[model samples]
Target chain A: MDLNTVKERAGPREFSPADDLPREYREAATRMIEFHANSEIMGAYLERPFIRQAPSIDRKLAFSAKVQDEIGHGQLLYRAAESLGVKTREEMLDDLANGDGKFLNCFHYPLKSWVEIPMISFFVDGAAMRRQATLRRTSWEPYAHAMDKVCFEEGFHVKHGEDILKELMTGSRAEQQRTQEAFEEWWPRIIQFFGPTDDKSTHHDFAASVGLKQQSNDELRDAFLDQYIPKARKHGLEIPDEPRIRERDDGTYAVEEGDLDWDEFFTIAKNDYEPGLGQINGRKQAQEAVQWVRETIEDDATTAGGHAPQAAD
Target chain B: MAALENPADLDEREREALETLLKRLADDEFVLAERYTEWQVRAPSLESDLALANNAQDELGHARLWYDVLEDLGFEEQELVYERDPADFRHATLVELPFEEGDWADAVLRSYLYDAAEELRLEALEDSSYPKIADRVGKIQSEEAYHLEHAQNWVERLADGEEGHQRLQDALDRLFPHALTLFEPVDPDVETDIVDLGLRDATLEELGEEWLSIVVPYLESLELELPVSSQVDDDTFEITEEMLPEKRGRDGSHTDAWADLHDELTHTYRDLGRSETTKIMEKPE
Candidate 1:
């Protein structure tokens, strides 16, 4: 299909792999879905350490399940991206490991302690879920289908994260204080999760025009702030004064875009942020270490006729 | 032996036998699950990562169920896990050994060996005189079936290629001796009590023999060597005393790796000075 025809026909689940789409449409969807797939992986990498560090068996189990779900989401999304025929899963993952792939800005920063967990799990994930809920109607059928499963499993994650927040807020003075401090530190980064406002975002116009993106950055950010600002207060976490947020007459919230560190966001966007490079290389080392295993399995799948049982001794 | 239904009325000997058996079961699952989490995001593929993570959660859930029974004897999750001495753990040393980086072979081979033994052990507990142990076995065994199948599939595929076969060989040789510790006795005398009191229908030696019969033939079929002798066609397998590791975990002796793992898993609990562990899931009904 031509660009004009594609733009006109864009609607929920309108596009599939069978379509003879123009290059522009395919590349745009691939870039958007690949970024999303990369984010799921990077996000899981960030949360993995906490699986070992969880203070309780139940919490550890929940964290492991959540991280596993993120990897599973990555799997679904890569397939969705691959459906565009623009890139393969291996290439996408390799780009992520090589620091050439871009993901969400929040994942670039390190998550240090248990107190910082709910910051990512609750606030960051909450923001992502707000955006993803809209993408359930995305023009790419596979991407939207993947979103169906992602949205189903993500509710548990957001709730589990919030549960951690609730626990920390009600904990001892030291625990509560530490959690609040973590909130203040992470608040700006969480706000940046929606990315720059509509005017500043480079790809938003084409993506939305094609129906791949259902809502603008400004709309998603405002929606997230409205839902989560009170949650922070209800949990006794004082919203950081900076990234000055204002409540509108309709009671929705808006972040002072000037207050967020866009330079840092863009640096992370370029995969040049110092800490993010560590994350990228760390995952790369892990992937490289397991390269032999992947090769072994891949070779076996091709060579073996059909999983014939090993000859009995 | 009659089923021992009430936890309150057990005498000293019965209590010791029951508690010792429970610790052995719980510690094995808990520690193995802890090791399995090392593969969370680092496994060979995303699908593999998810599979291993699911296995980790399954084993941990089984550990939770066993630990819950110990609470009937006045143990709390804090005392049972977070605050317990590493040396006090009664898991086989095989589960505690650290995974070599990029060693998918070790992960799969270890799972195959451990899950094979686990199937036999759980079956022995299926008719335990301790009613709680018997009741919980069915729930645990159902999940364990998938673990064993998953492990076998991976191990077989890994053994197919030249390099994978060698990797599987190396993993098997290193892991074989430690795997025998699965059947080591906590106290030789208490082991006898476990059988006599009907806490498990099979003795450790019996379970060990059955495990060898299954795993030896399976691995040898894939051209992997065992550290012990097995005459597969004749239905005879022997596990000599020398084949067992010096630090058999069942007796509260463990490799150095177990201590480091224990410290790491408990770091958060200790870091947060508050006294208790949190419970997110409702107590397993």
Candidate 2:
């Protein structure tokens, strides 16, 4: 801790490759980074439609910046990961399109309207951030740094989501109905985002052995329940399942698990479930609509007219 | 537009010049914002995506202030934005062009080229006789200053990387002619009136020349060439009145893209049916 000792330890890395580190640690970081990065990248697919399809200017513009921020966050995380020894970002994305990579279950489902955004940003993103915080000290320096940067900015997103949710949770009857329904639809999936039960094999030991994650999926889910369940109930909206409680004779309370709607839950969690079929189709239509631009890049690469002449022809 | 902070003192030409200047500023900024908005959630890189979103918001913010002026000048904010037909929109062809999806090259080139033009326009406005407009021009200029730098960063990065250099060349070849057209003259009479009123400090050619001065050096430094000045031609598919949907957009000329934008931008509001029917929490005064 002395200054001279600190200085002695400082300066450039004196040498390189002392160790490969743990495979579990390394690979988990890879999965976590790619998972987070992909989440940021594809997160927009679920958001923009709601923004573009918003029934009002204020809502449209409001959603615009948040969606943009997410896409940007994807960029930031990707660049950070690129510096790490993870899979190339291009490969990661290919994995995404192929469905080999999974996004948060919250994104797989649809946002039927603006109310969905509040639930997503607040409840879902709130859960994601809590789980994400556990990774902030990840053995992989790059991911840890990226998470540090991201967690700071994410507060705005959560607050923005909460603001919208609060407006509706207390608003007119239609607004309340819409909010309640959306919350119910989203809770389990959002809960599920902490991920499936700790397999203790692929998810716990092997995953850690390969550096796929620093925390267990169940712990992350528990963190979410710890953080949001009370808030959900406080809104006077019934928690869709029975109140998780502890039974006691002379004592007060103990924790119990409430049933989740699995049919819907796993539908989004498992790849086969296309909860947002119309949305996926809508997105594909949107993508095809802009093919000319992509083709232009490929085309420009092949031709001279494709390159801009600097002198001003 | 917000009653001028104090409106009673303006002369007629001052007001007219202000009005003319506003439409140009708003059209240019709004459409530029819209064009860049395409990259929202979809840019090839997240950093670039965020930057694009940042710039788009900047353009829209610029439009908002101009719209504020129009609202002051007696126009509804939404109508001023959503109702104009294609022919009536005076944004340069550069800002109006649809960005090909995932077209990182075009997006970089267009931003580099248009930001150059915008900086010149802002500089000209900063010297205008309209005091309030000049103040805004100054404030907007601060943000745009970074935009030029950011675009220049991408342009240089593209021009420097092995693949980047080639993409820059192709982007230049395709987008240069369009870039030059960003200097396409405004209504000549309107131009003269604007200059005479001292609301714009320079003519289109002068501003174009001013833009070229900075851009030429930057591009040359990167060894990425541009089209020859003599070969510059306007081959734009200018969206005209015919391009708009049946009833909307200036001159009714808009691509289907515009219609999609309109719906997304207005969906929530439209669901409200009438503007006055719903009320969000009023921001405290």
Candidate 3:
């Protein structure tokens, strides 16, 4: 399809693998979906340790299930990305392991303690959910289909996170104080989660024009702030003073934008931030550690024709 | 034998016997799940990560059910898990052993051995003299079927290749001794009561023999070593004491790995100085 034709047909679930589209559309969709898929993996990598560290059996179970769901989401998303035929899942995962893939700005930093868990589980995931809810109408049919399941399962995660926040806030004064400190430290990173304003975003125009991106960075950020600012207050968390947020007369919220550290943001965006590099290489070592298992299984599939005979007694 | 339907009706000796059996069941599931969570993002593939995570959660959930029964006897989560001494855990050493990096072979083989015993153990409990134990068996057995199948499937695939087969053999050799600890009695006197009172319809010896009949043949079929004499005498398999680990977890003796794991899992609870553990789900009915 020509550019104008693709533009005209850019509606919800309008395109599929059967449709022959321009290279620009396919590449754009592949880039967008691959980033989403990679974020799911890195985000899971960040939260994986907490599964072992969760204070209660119930909490540990919930953490394991949540991390599992994120990996499952990655599986779904890679298939969606691969449907574009631009890159396979193996290549995408390799790129992520090699520090060439980009993920959310929030995940680039360290999650140091249980107090900081709600910061990612509640705030950052809440922000991701807000953005993902809009993408159910994305022009790519498989991406939209994947989003449907993702949005359904993500509700449990957001609530589980909020429950953790509520528990901390209602606990002893020391626990509340520690959680508030974590919130203050993580607030700006969460704000940066939506990325730079619409006009300043590098790929926002074409993505939005082609309907791959249903909401702009500015709009998603505003929507997130409108919903979550009160949630933090309701949980007795004091909003951090920096990255000054302005509440408009229309009851929408906006960050001053100047207050957020864009230099760090851009460095993370380029996968060059020091701690972010650590996150990438840590995952790389883990991936490489298990490379033999993958190769062995692959070899077995070819030699055995994907079938193993039942063991004789 | 008549069922002991109510926790209050048990005499002191009966209570101790029931508690011993429950702890054996609960601790094994709980500790195994803890080791399984180490692979959440580190599994060989994303799909495998999700699958192993599901098995982890299932094992943890089963642990929850057993722990809830303990709560009926007036023990809470804090005392049962978070504040319990590391030496108090009654799980088998098999479940507490740490996995080597990238040891997918160990993960699958351990699951196979543990789940093989778990199925037989649950079957014995199906006709338990304790109503509570019998009541929860069906729900748990439903999930165990999937876990066993998943483990067996992975083991078969890994056993097909040269390197994979060698890894499986190495893992089995290292783990077989520890796996025998699963049948070790927490207390011989209580074990006698456990069988005499029909708390579980099978004795430790019976369960071990049954488990071997299933797993030994299966492993031999895949060209994996038995780690014990494959010889059968008079239609019975013997689990000699020589096959057992020095530190059997059921007797409250554990490897150093258990202490480190115990510290890490309870680190948050101690750090927060909280006396209570949080509960995210409703108590099982």
Q: Which stretches of candidate 1 lie over 4 Å from their true place?
A: A304-313, B231-236
| Arranged by TM-score, best first | 3, 1, 2
Best by DockQ: 3
List the pairs of residues colliding in candidate 3: none
Clashing pairs in 1: none
Which scores greater on lDDT, model 1 or model 3? 3
Proportion of true contacts reproduced by candidate 3:
0.80
Ranked candidates (lDDT, high to low): 3, 1, 2
TM-score of chain A of 3: 0.97
Per-residue accuracy of model 1 over B145-213 as CA lDDT, tens digit each: 999999888888779888889999999989999999998999999999999999999999899889988
lDDT of 2 by residue, A174-194 (tens): 778877887777666666666
lDDT, candidates in the order shown: 0.91, 0.63, 0.91
- What does candidate 3's lDDT look like per residue over A119-220, in tens digits? 999999999999999999999999999999999999999999999999999999999999999999999999999999887899999998998999999989
lDDT of 1 at B242: 88
TM-score of each: 0.97, 0.72, 0.97
What is the number of residue pairs that collide in model 1? 0
Instruction: Return the TM-score for chain B, candidate 2.
Output: 0.78
